[model samples]
Target: MSLIKTEELVHDYIRRDEEGNEDGRIRAVDGVSLNVNRGEFIAILGSNGSGKSTLAKHLNAILFPTEGSVWVDGKNTMDPDEIWDIRETAGMVFQNPDNQIIAQVVEEDVGFGPENMGIPTKEIWERVEESLKAVGMWEYRKASPGRLSGGQKQRVSIAGVIAMHPKCIILDEPTAMLDPSGRREVIRAARALNDVEKVTIILITHYMDEVIYADRVFVMDKGRVALKGTPVEVFKHVEELKALHLDVPQVTLLAYELRKRGLDIPDGILHMEELIEVLEKICR
Candidate 1:
């Protein structure tokens, strides 16, 4: 059964001018239907303002569909009784780590969620240890969050979510504010959560490189899923993605260009090693 499902979902809201005048209804998410299975790592890619983030908000019940329906973990988000249940089932990590990290200490911040849920003090500490260790931040557990690097801070934020023990986590552009190393750290932590803890991960990002690790990829455009497939399958449409102003990974782009120049290369060369293996075979 699908862990999360949306049926013909539509989210619309009125725009307002600075003078507080209504500027009519704007459709941010238009008739989107999606199914996310348990423990699957799904990536949603889009340029800014494509409504990918808006769509994600629906998954966690932050925004109700203007027209359709959203079901998370077999419960309808529209049901008032299921709101907290849905939120607890699917944790959310936003773009800014600074905004999410509440406590001064790393371990304290990680335990905050579970504590709010009324978990016992001992259980909360145990959860804090495991969550921080899961994100490779155990060594810095007692350190002040303000003293950490961007990557470290982001990892702590993820640990905070993991401490909640949610079945699924939705990250909306979690790497956008970090350096390359920070981005890698956050992505690695996300992958570890999916692979080791059997957690369902929904990674909403614009970085093409990040999508390569996802089990499935969804490319959004103008409030709709313009493309959906595995990373290789989605990246195969290089020209189309470019037209949509999206990018492919560097190696994929190079492979595509080489194919165009008649080098007998295939499309969607995701990793450097894959391209190297193919080139070796051709050269031999």
Candidate 2:
């Protein structure tokens, strides 16, 4: 069964005037319909103002749809009784780690979610340990979050969400504020959670490199889906992506260029290794 599904979802933000009067409406998400299967790794790509983040908020019920419907783990997000249940079933991690981490200590921050859920003290500790270990942050369990690097702090943030035991995770540009190394660290942790723990992951990112490992990719523009396919299938259309003000992975771009130059390379070369292997075959 699909872990999350949206049907013709539309969300509009009310623009206000200086006098706090309703000026107009800005459609953030426009008639978007999609399905995310259980244990799948899905990536959403969009330039600024494309509504990917707005669409994610709908999955967790942070914002209700102005039209259409959203079902998270088979529960409607619009239902008042299911709001908390929907949030617990689909946890969210945002772009900034600092905004999410609240407690002084790492373990305390990780345990906060479960504690608020009224879990037993002993079980909370168990969840804390498991969550930290899952993100490779267990060694820093007792350390102050202030003392950690950006990557470590983000991992702790992820651990906090994991403690909630959500069936799916919506990461809204989780790596946007991080350095290259920090980005890699958080992405690796997210992949590990999806691969090892069978957690369905919906990653919203601008980095083309980050989506290479995703099972499917969705690209948005003007608050609507512009393209949807596997990474290879989507990246093959260099012109389409460029027109949308998006770029493919570096290797994919290079391959596309080579193909344009009349080389015998295939479309959608995802990695440097793949490009090299193809060139080697052409040379032989």
Candidate 3:
């Protein structure tokens, strides 16, 4: 069953003059229709101003559609009565970990969501522990969040969301500001949530490498979905991505180059390991 669905979704932002006079409307998302299945790991990719983030806000009802509808776990986002339930059904993690982490202590911050939801104290603690452990942050639960590395802090932010026990998690460029190591850590934790916890994941990122593990990818362009497929299927359009002002994974680019040079390599080589396997077969 589809955990999230959008029907002809359209979102428009009103452009205003400096004097605060009404100007015109700019369509941020235009007639997007898609369904995300339960337990599916979906990635949305796009360059800036392409509407990826605008589309993500609709997933959790952060932004209501201007011309269509969004449903989260069968709850309509337009319904005011179901707003809280819809939010709880689909949690969101934004790019800045520092902005998300509230409590000074890691454990306290992780428990904040459940605590706000009025979960029983005992269960909240259990969730706090498990969520931290899920992100490999249990050992430093008592430490100050300020002292944690960028990656560790991001995991704590994720743990905080996981503690809410949402059915689906939408991460919008959650690793955008992190260093390479931090990006890997946040991505690893995101994958674990899908694999071990069986949670539905909708990840929005510009980094092609980050989407390699996604079950499916949707590439957005000018407020519409320009491409949709598995990572291998989507990465085959290396030049297309470059044209969109986006980058393909390094290994995929290399494979594309080799294919251009008359080598019979596959189009979407995701990683060095996959490329090595293909080369080994060719050498045999």
User: Candidate 3 clash total?
Assistant: 0
What lDDT does model 3 reach?
0.94
**How much is 157 displaced in model 3, in angstroms?**
0.5
RMSD of each: 1.5, 1.1, 1.4
C-alpha lDDT (0 to 100) for residue 262 of candidate 1 = 91
Q: Which candidate ranks first by TM-score, i.e. highest? A: 2
Clashes of 2: 0
Q: Number of clashing residue pairs in every model?
A: 0, 0, 0
> What TM-score fits each model?
0.97, 0.98, 0.97
TM-score of 2: 0.98
Give the per-residue lDDT digits (tens) of candidate 1, residues 124-215. 99999999999999999999999998889989988998999999999999999999999999999999999999999999987889999999
Range of the 10 consecutive residues with the lowest summed lDDT in candidate 3 = 259-268
lDDT of 2 at 243: 89
Query: Considering only N, C-alpha and C atoms within 3 Å, which residue pairs clash in candidate 3?
Result: none
